[model samples]
Target: MKKDVILELAQRLRQAGISGEVVDPEAADGLSDLDEAYAVEGATRSLALGAGERLIGYKIGLTSQPARDAFDAKEPAVGHLLAGRQLEEGRPVPVAGLFQPKVEVEIAFILGEALPGPHVTAEDVRRATVAIAPAFEIVGSRWRGGARSLPMLVADNTNAAWISVGARTEALPRDMGSTAATLSVGERTIAGSGTAVMGDPAEAVAWLAGHLLRSGSRLEAGDVVMSGTLCPPTDIKAGDHLVAEVGGLGRIVLDVV
Candidate 1:
């Protein structure tokens, strides 16, 4: 894609984010490939950073096979997480500023050491981790009616919106793949295991590390990497109270207002 086209697409997406409006997915048609899509994402990241938003870490999306299939993605997608978008546990999330918001239960990995990679492994991810926490990833798409193509989705920053994290634990779980997660909204509840996220949450992080390295970046120490969701995302609305529990990690509470 041409540089000007990439910038224009980035600006369109950023404006959509600012106005809480949805842009036409066709705006991303100029992207020639996933690489170009990520270039647009990079441009949007630059725009946010230039606007004084701090980059906290990154989030991995479509780590589950079903999620990948839904978006026609061959692999997971990555997005930058901004500090300003992080919500403290117990704080109410205002739905008025979001577009098509949904929630996912995830395990957050707070890296203790940098994982600069081409050779990063799940074990390496484990070794680098200092703490893990139960988290709620509140995702929203800026593309009208949601993203229609992988390139459009990636260019929209994988629909990242906000994240509410709970307490962190330095003690590693016995077997992350076996770790269980349960999310409840009002009277309904959904559950899944860490295996849902690319067989193991750590493996998802490992995959993210390699993906980042390929794109000239790496997971740095203190970065909060959201491995992926444990189950399918659920729609959220105003006055909704959500609770997510990750066995051995603890729980996080989110109240939508």
Candidate 2:
């Protein structure tokens, strides 16, 4: 992709983000290739930084079977997470700042040490992780269409907006794959487990580390990595209070305003 086109897409995304308007980025040419899509993502990150958003971490998406099924993808997609988009525990997120927001329950890792990987394992992620938290990933799309393809989603930061994190815990579970999760909004509920995310949440981090290695990058200390969602994302509305409880990891609450 040309640098000009990349910058153009970044401006489009930035405008869409602020106005809560959806755009069809595919309408722009040369975003079909995987590498080109990632280039566009990088340009968007640069644009966000220029607007004063801090780079905090990364997120893995489509690792859940349901998400993969929804996007017709065989593997996970990765995207940038900005510090400005991170929410404090129990805070209300203004719905007006987002476009078609939805929420998903997840387990997030705060790395204690840098991890550079081509062959990183789950145990590697476990050793590097200093703390864990129950999290809610607030997802939205700049894309105008209802459903999306991998390349299109990749170029749009995998539909990420804000990540609502609960309190951190040092007592990491022994078997994360077996960790249970329950997401509740008012009376409606959805249940899943860590295993729904690539067998183990650590494995998802490991996968991300290895994937980043392909681009000559690494996961650094203090980086917060969000593993994939435990279940399909739930559409949120104003005045909704959503709670996600991860067994042994405590709970996170997100209030949509």
Candidate 3:
């Protein structure tokens, strides 16, 4: 994909995001491959960073088999995470600022050391992780409904909107795969385990690091990576108070208002 084409698609995405108007990604050319989609994402990141948003970390999408099947793909996707959208524990997740809002449970890893990909393993992620916390990744798409593919999702930054992180724990469990997560919205609750995310949350981080390294990037210190979701995402609306609990970790509350 040409640089100009990438920039053009990114600008369209930015406008669609701000105006809450979903656009079709197929309308853009050269988005057929993952690399091209990533290029578009890089261009979008550049636009966001140029507009004063700081890159805090990255988001890994579709690490679980179910998630991948839903997207009609076998591999995972990655997205950039900006600083201002990082909400603290117990903070209100303002719905007024989002486009088609949804939420999912994830374990966020804050890195203490740089981990470059390709050779990065799950143990490497665990060793480099300085803190682990329960998180809610608020997802929103800038694209309208249609035959959306992984590339389209990738180009849209893996539908990243906001990240709500709870209190961080310095010690990670010996078996992160066994950690259970429950997401409650009012009376309905959805449950899953860390194993849903590639058998372990750390494994997802390792996958993202390796993917980034293959693309010539690395996960740096101070970067917070939102490992893949534990369960399917729940659609959200205004006046919805949501809580996510992770066993052995802690809980994070998000009020959609």
Candidate 4:
């Protein structure tokens, strides 16, 4: 895609209130894997980067095999988180701008200080964290039926969507990295787990911080990176009452319509 084309397409995505799906001329060359996906994510996020909005943090998903298999894809993808997506806990997730939406329960981080890039350890994240908040990532897909190609999803912002975070917790849990839990939609329980995310949530954040640093970026203070998912993402419909109770992090709830 030409520079103008890419930019225009991106605008359409933004204005449409949903990530845009593009058909790359050389689809295979556009993106080969998850790593490349983030590369494109950086390029696209640049559209919002340095625009006066501060980086909050990062979030991860697809920590479970079933979650990965749910997409029938390998590796996992990341997104450039923005403060705009941070929805208050118990608020209804706005659905007007999403397509083929879904939800994933995740542990969110509140950084205490700016994370220096080039290399950040799990300890760095722990030390910088002000609190560990529970959150629900509203995931949407570029394609119907939950399947997408590598490049397809990359240009689609890895299906980036709204993120609803629970109240902040100051007393971080001991085994926050591997705390098991359950996701509930009102009385309808959906999925549950903890260690499913990269075996450790802290490590996931560390890895992402370093990964961005290597690409000439740094994890900004107050940035909320959504690490990979703790359980398989469950599809959701409007009017559904969503609840996620990660044993160690308490629980968070949201509804959509």
Candidate 5:
């Protein structure tokens, strides 16, 4: 894709995020591949940074094989997380500011050491972690009718939105892949295990480390990485109170308004 076209799409995405209005899917038509998509994502991130939004960390998307297969992707996609988009625990999330938001439960890893990887492994991720927490990722899309293609989705920052994190603990699970989690919204409850995320959330983090390294970036010591959702995303509405409990980890509470 042309540099000018990438910047133009980035501007469209930025405007859509600010106005809470969906952008035309055609706006990303110029994106030809994942590389181009990431170019647009970087451009979009630059625009946000210029506007005073701080990059806090990164989020991994499509960590499950099913999700990867659906998108014809061989690996997970990455997105930047901004500090301004973090939702406070126990605070009401304003629905009016979001566009078609949905929630997913995830295991979050707070790094204690930088993982500058070309050969990082899941065990490396575990050894470098300082804490783990149950988390709620409120994903929203700024593209009309959602993203029409994988590249389009990537260009839109993998549907990044609000992230509300729960309490953290330094004690790591004996078997992260076996760790379980349950998400509840009122009387409805959905269950999933860490195995759902690339068989192990730590492995997802490992992949993230390599992914970042390829872009000349690395997982910093203080960075928080959302290892991807354990279960399918559930639609959320105003007045919805959601709770997620991770086995051996704490619980997360999010109220939508």
Candidate 6:
């Protein structure tokens, strides 16, 4: 995609405070024709328009191998973080504004300082992390019934809608990947995964930093990063019990409605 079109779309969407039915494929020769950077920039613009703020951090979606195979993606896709969409632990995720929502378990990170991208390491992620927190993410696909194209979902903040940040755990392990944990929604076990997230949740965070740096973006201090889904995402419904607990990390709960 043309650099000008990227900024233009962002500018237009920000000014309008409304999302187009889908980016005019012709406008940028079809987003599928463009690269990932263009998609990320367009999404950044849309969010900036609709009361979106600076990207605190990013997320690496589809971390599990099974999920990776299902999506036919060799690597993880990224998404921006918005403060307005963040939710506290043990809170209900508002069903409004979400169409065909799904939920995933993840470990979130709190950065301590600015960490520019394009050349970051899992250790960099480790140094930047102040703590690990249990999290449940509400993913709303731009497509119906969870059918989302890679470019489409990437452009729509990785289908990221709302996030439930659970309690911050004790000091993080040197290698968070090996950590084992269970997830439950009000006494009922949902599913579980740990180091399964890209071999290390920090690695996923590192990938985001590098991806953004190459796109002229950077991770800032005090930013919250969604490492990625530890387990496969599950369909969600109202009145469901939603609780998540990482091995070393504690637990968090939210209501479907």
Global lDDT of each candidate: 0.90, 0.86, 0.86, 0.68, 0.90, 0.70
Whole-model alpha-carbon lDDT for candidate 3: 0.86
Writing each residue's lDDT as its tens digit, candidate 3 over 1-257 gives 77788889988887776676777756655677888888888988998889998999999988889888998887888999998778866678876545568899999999999997578998999999999999999998887763277888888888988898888999999888999989999888999899989999898898888788888889999999999898788889989989889998888898997
Q: Write the per-residue lDDT of candidate 1 for residues 12-89, one digit (tens) a residue.
A: 998888888778767766776898989999999999999999999999999899999998789999999999889975
* C-alpha TM-score for every candidate: 0.97, 0.95, 0.94, 0.82, 0.97, 0.82
lDDT tens digits, residue span 68-89, model 5: 8888888899999999988875
Error of 3 at 151 (Å): 1.2
Candidate 2 runs further than 4 Å off = 97-99
- Tens-digit lDDT track of model 2 for 1-257: 67788778877877787788877745555676778778878888888899898988999999887778887888899999999889876678876656578898999999999998678999999999999999999888887863257777888889888898888998888789999999998888989889988999999999999989898789999999999888678889899989888999988887888
Residue 146, candidate 5: C-alpha displacement in angstroms: 0.3
Q: Count the backbone clashes (under 3 Å) in each candidate.
A: 0, 0, 0, 20, 0, 4
lDDT of 4: 0.68
Residue 97 in candidate 1, Cα distance off native in Å = 4.9
In candidate 6, what are the lDDT values of residues 1-257, reduced to their tens digit?
55555666555433322332334333433456327544644556565746636555567786767767776777777777666668765567866545567788889898887788567999988888887898888887543334345565555556777888887854988878887667665555666666678888888888888777876778888888898887667777788887666777877778888
TM-score of 2: 0.95
Better model by TM-score: candidate 5 vs candidate 6: 5
Instruction: Give the range where candidate 6 is weakest over 10 consecutive residues by summed lDDT.
Output: 13-22
In model 1, the clashing pairs are none
